[model samples]
Target: MRLKFQFGSFITFIGFILSSLIVTLDLEAQTHQFKLIDEETNRPIPDANFFYGNEQGISSESGDITINFQPTITLTISHLQYGKRSFTAEELDQALKKHQLALQPKSHNLQPVTFISIHPNAGEQEQMTLQVQDKLAHDAGQVLEQFSSISSIRKSGAYGFDPVLRGFKYDQINLVIDGSQCATAACPNRMDPASSQVPLNMIVEAEVMKGPYSLRYGNAFGGTINFKSADPSFTDKANLNGRMGTSFETNGEISRSEALLGITSKHADIKLFGSLSTGNDYTDGDGVKIPANFYRSNIGGKIGLKLNSTQTMSLQVSNNYGKDVDFPALPMDLRKDDTWLINLGHKAVFYRGALSSWSTTMYATKVDHLMDNADKELNPRMVDANTSAKTNNAGGRTELRFDFDDDWLYAGTDMRIENADGTRKRNMLMGPMAGKTLTDNVWQDARIRKNGLFAEYHSQGDNFHLVFSGRLELNHAEAQNPDAGFAANYTDMSSDIVSPALSIGGTRTVTDNFSIGLWLGSAQRSGSLAERYINYFPIGLDPYEMIGNPELKPETNNQADLIFNYKSDATDLNLNLFSSFLNNHISSEIRKDLSPKMATAPGVRQFVNVDKAKIMGFEASWKQIINRKIQQVAELAYTHGQNTTSDEALPEIPPMEFRYRLIGSFINKKLRTELNFRHAFEQNRIAKSYGETKTPAFNVLDIKASYLIVQNLNVAASLQNIFDEAYYEHLSRSVRNAESRPIYSPGRSFYFSLSYRF
Candidate 1:
């Protein structure tokens, strides 16, 4: 069913609000938009500082800003390379009429590595401005892992590189796309995670927050990562534009290609995009072929309509498909997977100055997956095994913001409903039950629904900035059909839970070039469908069949962070020290009293609460612009996690790691070269109880170069794993082979790309 039909009353009320905006007046007299660009190159400049009236804000990617329109007002803008400039009322009026503004360059070259921006959110730590030549990856997770130190990926096979952050993965880390969270994985082994399902070619920007210091984006227990797409824009003149790109890799004989087309008029715009990727198994550093082969295709489009000067509406639709994917880490391989998504959005600036603006987004998505061991050498009793699963999700969020000079108040409501079902067929060719087929319920008609209300307040002063937010949620979960014996073990097959979350953060300027900040937060995360409804399935990091616990309580994370920052004309540096304490942490314990249901797995484990858990970490980042020709970005991060109740180390904590990137510009900024290096320290703190092993240290180097051949055409090339180093991440899962060792990294590989835009 459509999300609108599922949320009948809610959609009706929001629609009424949308209609009522016509009569409402924006008393603030705001609505002027400006795009800041380089005076010499005419390219957009990010992280520019602008001040007007009582508001001082930083420009986002491409230096786009919207402010109150006042003929008598004066605006001041400043940048590291562009220096400072002031625009008088007359100049502002002229710039507004022409719809073009530029700042003079103070140096011969322009370089930007990392900086802070105000909108989007206050807690944003980093932003990756994606480009066609830079983001040549098969999935979104690969694109994210290169952007920040706080982000990592748990590689499963050729397809699923699920995102991990701050020692948390899966449901603990919330990943959203254009304000909607709807990725639902169907495989118990997570062969196709949320990051893999979202079309990577559609993303224009990626941003991340370090911790759960905000409540406006759902129950973010660990942190939040938001993937943003190009907003459909209306131009005064009719325009038709598009971009196409193709890439090739020597290793695994990989090939990838994507294309985008857009048409815009005075009041409407539409965009279409598509991509295809195919690859075979690649040899590792040891000259051994890994089980990594896959084929994927994606198609998507977006539409936008400008109702008036104060209102805009958008709609998006997408489909993704995968086939013949191999997963060496798991017992089953992905035969086929398909996903469909539809999203609707509306925004309006109120009249009469009663409300600054209000926006709403509603989306529906579904994933259908099938996995089996058809290629594997079948065991005697378990000749063949096949499981089919699917997940359906529908959700919406609406927010109303009121601006008051240097402060703003925001109130919003969000809701999500999900349904899951799956069945596994086991074919017997030997043993006592030869030539007989057995059917087992993996997820017997499970459902999870949640409704939430949230509020946020922001205040800014000459030397300090403060942000406060809170959220209240009501969650419901149930299982309609469960195995008879499993049902009898846990009588309560349903639960209704109430969860609350809040956070407060403030930053103080201590001196001319130094600042300090502190953040404290607490969040609650409810159990997932598998955590509460799975039957006898080997779904955990261990090799034990797991049973569900319908009566599981919500987990909580109480966290604090101490931040130090320093900024200068040529460099920006930041350091963060953080700790998290958890209560009611969900864990698995062997259920000796129960008998095994899956023949290959003899042990049975049940989900339970671990009384206490903790994770502590620190991160340091540095960005330096050297002489406007060479810029460098570096990061160092470390994390330690433990099950405090059991006095043991956590299972999947990553080791200390460091990364560095150096960029050099030549030929009037048309040719760019970058060198990348990474080092990971050895990890000896293993969770022996979970059969975890130690990992050795390793280092890798890479180099890339891109050149603009013409006005709108570019060529790029890169060599990865330059040393052909054989290594594996500490968080890598053990493969299904008898050796039980993690998969090795790929050997030296070369890639090339050519792209054009008009």
Candidate 2:
């Protein structure tokens, strides 16, 4: 076997030499000066990859690259957002002389952030730039709602939309901000999820990992959402910069304003930013007003010090506050929410020896939440209930990466501590208990601590790449209140979970334009605080109460994926097929039995462990340049899931969806217009035991246009749902009444935006 491996390596080296010689002979003395820019904006496209023969390098900040190669040699230029493009040496020379070498950007809606392993297959990583995100999502609240694979569950109209990815949501998915875990929601009903805390404008980029194939992030059973916030940029000398902008929307009379300021020096840098937004009740397509009023404000800053050329330390702090929020799906409204976050980090780099780099990070978060039914229209016999809660999260992580010949290893340790304490007070009005006040601890000082050690190994070969990772974690949780009405069913509330994570995948390049890849992985996720210890909490959007089971076991998933990619000068295609089998799956079961203390509850359910379950899905995307002035793109996604243990379909699974976009650029590519058509098939498969309902099919059309008025001034206009169709997503919540009709989406509205950079 060793001899055969050696022979294969020798043959590969020979083929490489022969290919280089053939290219060298084609052009004995040829030099190409290349300049890459955005086709639409004509701005420099930085950090783009360029390759010719065996020589490769990344484009500079100015998007300029000068290369000496054969006249017939092919040059490849690839980027995460722009897709991949190639040009011949002669074509490059002509473009350079004519000043027309620019990479055409793919429609942002169709791009997919994927994981692949080899040559032409692992060429690109998809992500949305800050500029694109800013244009699409006007407010921070709309950020996650724009993701293609994500569907928002709106307990409130537009305030807190929890993102569900591939039929998994909330604690089932891992949400990380700058490689660190944030605090969980303070509200028992999860009025505010983790993604709500990070303001949209503050994010520089967001990358979504579709499945558990990659485990660098912690306990990603369904997937991972990684958000990167804007940081201070380095400067040669002292410099100062800042920006301010404002916008208004017609549907809800929404108003928003934001500003950022930064000062940078050779050794130190500082940044400060803030935003404020307010909106009134939004009307539906039928002109019926929904009680969705909200107000939000946040302020944050960061300071960095350069200890040396290769070492740095930084400190960051942020605070967020919300007031007078209304939720139509629940019985209560949010009165106030105050949250604070702090992080301190250090990073260092080494140029020589086996050690490549190391980084350390520590972060803390605290949330104070208050809610009540004082502002809502309630029954005369109902009680006026008020709830207040506080949650704290703190953690630290340190990782070291080692590099050797053709191989790399990462070793790290991470720890997280979380605690929840809250209480609810009710006042009776006309009953025998009128004028009386009743108080109870909602969570009773519940505390959970998790510690983990992990390591990952990777290797590179001529035609195949390999990745493997493992992790061990310990979890302990307890609550102060042992009363029967509370979480008193604790027979040993501690579990030393030895969770193992592994992924093995590689790509085989069949040709320059085609590749095939396969990946297999196993991931495990322990139960969350709400799933394991909460006595009574409302599941967001769903009409059910959640009861905890302290003895519930962790969930494990073994998954497999296959990938196919095709890239050419005018076309890009990607398709993925994936499947997962889960063991000890945690799901909620409706309960009819009620104790004396719970007899008055509206809806009742308990968390339980299932023996087995399975899910399978596929995603496909295609992009083509129909002409020099037109582009066409299409994407399709669907997921099928089942609970074999209960012989039923999984609840809350999204239906089959597809999107088609037609983009046109004219006037020397300065002006752009887009017409998009979106469609969703009716969801007929649902778990009847969970009271899941079937939805009807719907189609919607949207039109948008943007133009650059001047060098620093830009304007954009959009007409959403041009026909004013009244429709609702499958995951939308129902009204908190006897009728329980699902909430409808917004009506047709005209939106316009303008901004100027100074």
Candidate 3:
């Protein structure tokens, strides 16, 4: 009896042990871990929010998180102002084993969330985007000029305004309207493009990305500007919104009026935006007439469809007509520029087990334009010398992202195609002989296509973070011209090019209030068709018709930057230093022996692979809240560049500048007022590459006042260039042999606006 009892006890003990082991295995399968890191610096972020099961969870003090999953588990990670991310059990396991997982921060705009997220800076160091309400409720140029990075603003003599960013001019910068590429053929002289299509009153917001970081938009060697129109907000309870405003400026003799109407439902939304502006020549600071006068009209429409919870599509079209646009810098002016643009895009998101989340978009655009000489000097001689040009572009980009738990990693690929065509006709009076007529036309009927693939990886630990990213791009270009005369002038060309880029950055946090970040990157750009095949008349730089250079090579640049940030509840300060080295910089230079009128003369201004160039700059900005009713934002920037081989100052470099803004609000924020001051140091180090023109320095002041009329209505007014100081941008191109040639900015202007929300 004793032996039998002992046997039964042993069997029971073994069974218990087996069951315990099986339960432990099941719990291990349900467990997961994650680490949160800063996007730019790749440093660990402590106390972030991590969610699993159906409820939100908290990260540990060391930026680490572990979760015991429930059945049908889903894991989500989120931080303040950063975009939220989530993953399924299968996706989490794959990401952890690969040791690569990352979540992108939210974009500046909250609506139409984007997957290609950039991290947010702490405190005042963060880049801020003006909301639609802010834009529609303020003066366009006045609001844009508030950013310290922008150095110059020129009213296009017509109704619109031209903004020169950093130092880049003309087509070197890319412009997008409603997320679609707007094509403009009006830049034959590199004067006006799609950026001029939208009046300030019609724009809901404009986002400018400085430097080569703009490659994602197009072949934007310098930068990219994106103009967004107001869309129906999902957060609004009502389905309709309407707004109207009017303003008059004394300096430019300008009168502007605009209106916007929008309708929204749960699934479908439509909007109509339009503006009308007219102005006459205005007097300068000294009461001298500047010959800056013109009239313009613009209209745009947008239609959007929300197909489902994760998919949306939109279509937009716009038209702009301008007459007698004048330019102080050029001898002959823009007589007429009629532009039209059409764009369409669709965005969607999908979730697939291990693949996680992905967002994709497809877009296309078309543009047409016509231009004529409008200067008083040319009108007396030529009567009419007009030119017309057109461009058509079609492209699409797709990006895929995968997130993991161990180390953050993201990868994507992009592709694009563009085509352009241009023509010019000359009508010369020739001493009343009914004017001799000459016509020249050029066509780029072929396609230029580009394909790129890229990947980025990030790792976050307790004290430090690291990131690595690389991209490879391939380009195929072909040009076809049907006009024999134009074809002979510009030889048919075809080429295949490849470019590669890499970036590495890291960050470390020494304490709770201080942190440092370092970044190094290299990028390359292939020449554009305009740079390689354009052979046309350049009105601004006379005694010379310009021709293209087919032998030009690609341009490359290497850059490094460092940033330090300090933060507190009431005050924030940031400092950054950066440097870049460019190789084979492609710039136009005159041929020494060519005569002034060889149809391609004034010495051929061909694009050449010039010597090396270097640029270095530093930027510092601070924001402080003096009290509950008062705050201040101040910024200072200095930049310098040189052409190493020529030992000459580089053309189109931003001068030293400073900006300050003071804000005061009262009556429980019902009333707000802001004061702005800006100063730019004289740019004496002028380059003689094109001409011996020197730009002077100046200072200006502005003020804005706003009053909330009701819960949905607001009234605001602004005064720009308050001091009416006379100034000219250093980068403005001058007409050859013109004594008074600098592009004069508007002297002083005042604007009043009213906004109403549904």
Winning model by lDDT: 1
Which regions of candidate 2 are displaced past 4 Å? Answer: 1-141, 540-542, 596-600
Candidate 1 C-alpha lDDT tens digits along 295-383:
99999999999887667788889999998888777778899999998888877754334355677888888999999988765444356
Identify the candidate with maximal TM-score: 1
lDDT leaderboard ranking: 1, 2, 3
What TM-score would every model get versus the actual structure?
0.90, 0.83, 0.78
Candidate 3, clashing residue pairs? 42-465, 83-106, 101-404, 101-407, 101-408, 543-602, 544-601, 544-602
Number of residue pairs clashing in candidate 2, backbone atoms closer than 3 angstroms, sequence gap of 3 or more or interchain: 0
Each prediction's whole-model lDDT (CA):
0.76, 0.69, 0.57
Tens-place lDDT per residue, model 3, 78-130, is 64324467788787776556333555433221111111111121111121211
**What shift in Å separates residue 320 of candidate 3 from its native position after superposition?**
3.5
Candidate 2 lDDT, 148-219, residue by residue in tens: 577777778768777888788888888877677576888887777787776554565566876776566577
- The TM-score between candidate 2 and the true structure equals 0.83
Candidate 3, which ten residues in sequence have the lowest lDDT sum?
109-118
Output the worst ten-in-a-row residue range by lDDT, candidate 1. Answer: 121-130
